[model samples]
Target: MLVLNGPDGKFVVDTFVAPAWPRLKEALDGLGNAPVKCVIDTHWHFDHTDNNTRLHAAGATVLAHENTKKRMSEPHDLPVLYRGTDGALAGLHFDPSPVEALPQQTFFDTCKLQANGESLVLQHVAPAHTDTDIHVHFENANVIQMGDLFFNWMYPYIDPSTGGKITGMIAAANKILSLAGNDTKIVAGHGPLGNKADLMEFRDMLVTSCDRVERLKSAGKSAQEVVAEKPFADLDPIWGNGIINSEQWVQVVYLTL
Candidate 1:
């Protein structure tokens, strides 16, 4: 977990991967044991929400999009550490479970909250990365926790299984661009912090890469052919790494476009 002490209060971003109890402790520790009145998750991913129970136990109100709470409530494939019972969580786990309990505060479209004097805006851009993906904007701090919408120096994963389409990913980037300005600092679900320029580049890469895949698909090329062609030949070397490789990206774009 990473800690950012804002003017109003403290922010413990990026929790554990499996949503364990200890990870919650780590997040609290990062805040210097400060009373966390509010908790904002970039998205509903385990790494970010695994500690929700612990934070809620400490009087911290967890905030997320309505869709996020609905998804978390369902029986999905969350790991044993995060799940209440056994048997693979299955895809339905995307919704809430009895033990998980949905986020207390839910917002659709856009909503803003003020705490310790800082104003934070939460927006729903789900079905972009996943059905529940949301972006948190720290207006006063000039920083934004982009959940999975923006990944710097790494491949951005668009989970097709959860309705994550490349076109939606492009829309997410555009939404970020709309909110971000020259001096805005951006924090992705993964990777290092960056500025608006970096985000613009990231968006461009996705647009161009998806365009390449669309062209290939129109030509009636097979998925293997598209992968072999390496359509992202002119893209940054790092854009094809992590879980979303060039091949996988081609597949997603083909399905989405």
Candidate 2:
């Protein structure tokens, strides 16, 4: 999550979760008691949007890509295909968000916001982590909040059910790289803050893994077969420690393909 203190008031990039509301509220209060004028949702995922209701109630206008509003406005079950604690394939469910938690204002390609005496460029990327992903670029600050588009060192969860795709993920990373300079601070959806180099590494990992998985699938390998082969063995030690493990990452890529 990122907070921008501009001339007008405070603008938040993404809300972490519902449980983190008190801490978030405190943080906002610490900012000289500025009102939250705007709250932006990078995507429709609960992790990034759970605090919408509270923030909106506090006089903030929620902004997000149209696709995000669509997803949050309805009941949907997000897929969770991963190895269980007992080594069995497992799945999970996600209910729809409340109406109060949904975005009130949305944009298509891009939207510009003038706040705190600076310009915020919110650009909607193609279906990447989710169809609703958007990059928040603070022009004067040279900081970019990449939502879930950049997972830092981990394998990203591509929600194909909501229009996420491996190729789109690559494209989204490239889009950030194109706009970023060496000094730009990148705020990832997860993990520590990063820079251009870290973003590059993430993009490369996605491309390399996607290529390997595609090759194996082309050779008639099933998702489980591809997982058993450990196609991303070289990258696992470095990028598989986060929420998404090797097998889970392979499954997501395969299912999207």
Candidate 3:
């Protein structure tokens, strides 16, 4: 999450996972009594928006892309593929988020806010990570919070069920790179903070991996065959160590393609 403090007040980006709201509140309390004027959700994912209710209840006006608000307002199940007790791939489900946690303020392509003496720009990057994904740029601070559109050093999870795609992910990364410079600090959705170079590397990785997977698929290879071929073997050591493992990453990309 990105928090900016200036003359106006305090502004927070992304509420983090649901279970961590209390800890977030405690940390916020320690920051004195600066009122939270706004809370922005980069997307509708539970991990990014679960604390909306608490923050909103505390008087923060929650804002997000229109798609995010719509997604959060309904019941949508997330698909989870994992190895079962028999060591075979199995599927699991993630229930929809609570309606109270939905964002009240929604925008289409872009939204701008002036707070804490900073200019905050939220720009939508569609069909990447999720349909509701957005990039939050604190212009005065030279920091950009790239919601789930960037995964830093890890293989990103693409939710096709929500309009996420490998190609769109690459496009989003490129868009961020275009907006950033050498000195800009980038706050990724997960993993460590990064800069333009890191984003470039991530974009390259996505392109190469997608190309490899596409080639295999074009040759009439099955998803299991593509996985066996280890299309992203070279990248697994560095980017595959995050929440999305190598095998799971392969499956998602292959299925999406």
Candidate 4:
């Protein structure tokens, strides 16, 4: 969803859904024919990789974490996408991505790249939102693009199916906070642009939620029972406004704990 105009050609970071491809293409075209030289997928999520094939066909090399390519090459079922008639969440299935859409290059731990007159530092975090989560730090610009590790003010979708851990989420936030400065621009995978303060609040929220959920689970409470208690009722006004409600967030936190 971000484009960087390098001195030679352009570089892109993440992408939108398939329906928005033309607009993305137009945006690239408007840059006076500087072909997209590279595309980076922060994770393997479909929302971030949907336009990979198109960009690849346009002569861009796709890059991502090694696990991202592995995840994309297999089928996945996410239960958060839909609610069933039985009042339970139904699975939203994703088939393996086509070979053309898979990343052509991948790194394991960390890597650095220079583009658009900026030094980009790419670092992969431990499993938080998903196993493939990574962050791109534009050192010169003082901007950090975190795929799903920091959700700004919204409650995040923690995919337990893909090695997401609440503790890992907390650690990721702490790591970013350590790297960010007062004036740094923190780009989240969801919600509005954030700052160190916003990320601090988010990290605090996750800590509080994790503590409460862990306590309830330790007391032998069921996940549904924890949801019924609405431990996050006080914090719901901000984080709960997203697709995940307080009740649902409680469930998610419980599972991860």
Candidate 5:
């Protein structure tokens, strides 16, 4: 977890999770006895928000998109899949947390937060990542914490079942571009950090992928065909190394579009 101290002396803690909680607390301790005032979660993914209980208990208010609140408060069935690794012995199971607490405040379009004299802009940019993904902009500091919208190196995961769309993905990227300049620091949900140029590249990739998927759809191509068709071959070398791959991406694009 990297702690960046804002101009107002407030610390913007990043990547607060299970494995990193001890380290995060240590970092906070290093900042003296100043109690954490607020904690702005980029999104409601368990990895990013499971520690919300602890933070809230420590006097920090948790914030997230309206959709994130809804999703987190709903019942979820665990996912179990068998890996064809030579036998039935290889498999994976995922058990998500049951509906619990939710964000007290949620906005459909945009919401701004002022803390410790620092201004933070939270904007909903969804149908691009999840049903309610948002971007946190530290306006004065010229830094944005883009939840899952901008994955620096890995292929972005588009949750199709939750209204995620390829077109919306591009629009979300453009929205971020409008809010930031060339030198603005971009903290991605995963992977390395980036800037405006990186954002443009991500936007362009989404646009190109959208165009490809649309074309394929118009050609009466099936989902299988779309997956088999590697329309994003150009981006494979740069952003295709992850659990999200060209085939899965194409399937999502085709399905969503």
Candidate 6:
């Protein structure tokens, strides 16, 4: 999550889960004691949007991409996300968010804003991680917040249920690379902070995985067959140490293809 002290009040980029609000509130209060004027949702994922109600109740208007509020208004079951305690491919069931937590203002394409004495540019990408993905670019500061598009050193989970595409993921990275310079700071949705070189490396990893998975898929190999072959064994030690293992990563890539 990012905080920008605006001319009027504070501008928060995203939020943590509801349980983290007290610590979040303390952090906000510690930063100049400014009221939150607005909160931005990078995407509709619960991890990024669970605390909207608290901040909204505090009188902050929420801003997000057009699809964010829509997605939040519906229920979702993502079996690819996890398995139940039974150890089968069952997903967590999500209920619709309360009306108070919904975004009040949304933009279709690109929106520009002036906050913290800096110009912020928000742009939508084509369904990379999820259909609601948007990146916030702080132009003057040369910093970019890639909502879930860049996963840093780990293999990213592509959400096929919401139109996530490996090709779109590649395109989104190129978009950021085009807008970024060698000195630019790239804040990823997960993992440590990154830069242009780090982003480039991550993009290359995506390309290699996509290409390998596509080849197997084209050769009439099932996702499980590809997983059994362990095509990504070499890349796993470096990139598969995250929440997703190599086998699961192969299935995810294949599904996107």
77-163 per-residue lDDT for model 2 (tens digits): 666665634353335467778888889999999999888878999999878888899999999999999999999888888887788
lDDT accuracy of residue 120 in candidate 2: 94
**Candidate 4 lDDT tens digits, 39-130:** 99989888889999999998999999999999999999876632323344425799999999999999999989987688999999999999
State the local distance difference test value for candidate 6.
Answer: 0.88
Error of 4 at 137 (Å): 0.4
The residue-by-residue lDDT of candidate 6 on 150-229, one tens digit each, is: 89899887877778888889999999999999999999888899999999999999899999999989999987788778
Top candidate, metric TM-score:
2
The most accurate candidate by lDDT is: 2
Error of 2 at 12 (Å): 0.5
Quote the positional error of residue 200 for candidate 2 in Å: 0.5
lDDT of 4: 0.88
lDDT of 2: 0.88
In order of appearance, the predictions have TM-scores of: 0.82, 0.96, 0.94, 0.95, 0.84, 0.95
| Each model's total of backbone clashes | 16, 2, 0, 1, 0, 0
Distance from true location, Cα of 214 in model 4, Å:
0.6
Alpha-carbon lDDT, every model: 0.69, 0.88, 0.84, 0.88, 0.69, 0.88
The per-prediction CA RMSD against the true structure, in angstroms, equals 5.8, 1.5, 2.0, 1.9, 3.8, 2.0
lDDT of 3 by residue, 125-150 (tens): 85888889999998988999998888
**Which segments of candidate 3 are over 4 A away from where they belong?**
81-92
Model 4 earns a TM-score of 0.95
Off by over 4 Å in 6: 81-90
Q: For model 1, how does the per-residue alpha-carbon lDDT over 150-254 read when each residue is reduced to its tens digit? A: 888776766655567778888988988988999998887777888899888889888887888888888999776786787876663768655455555665566
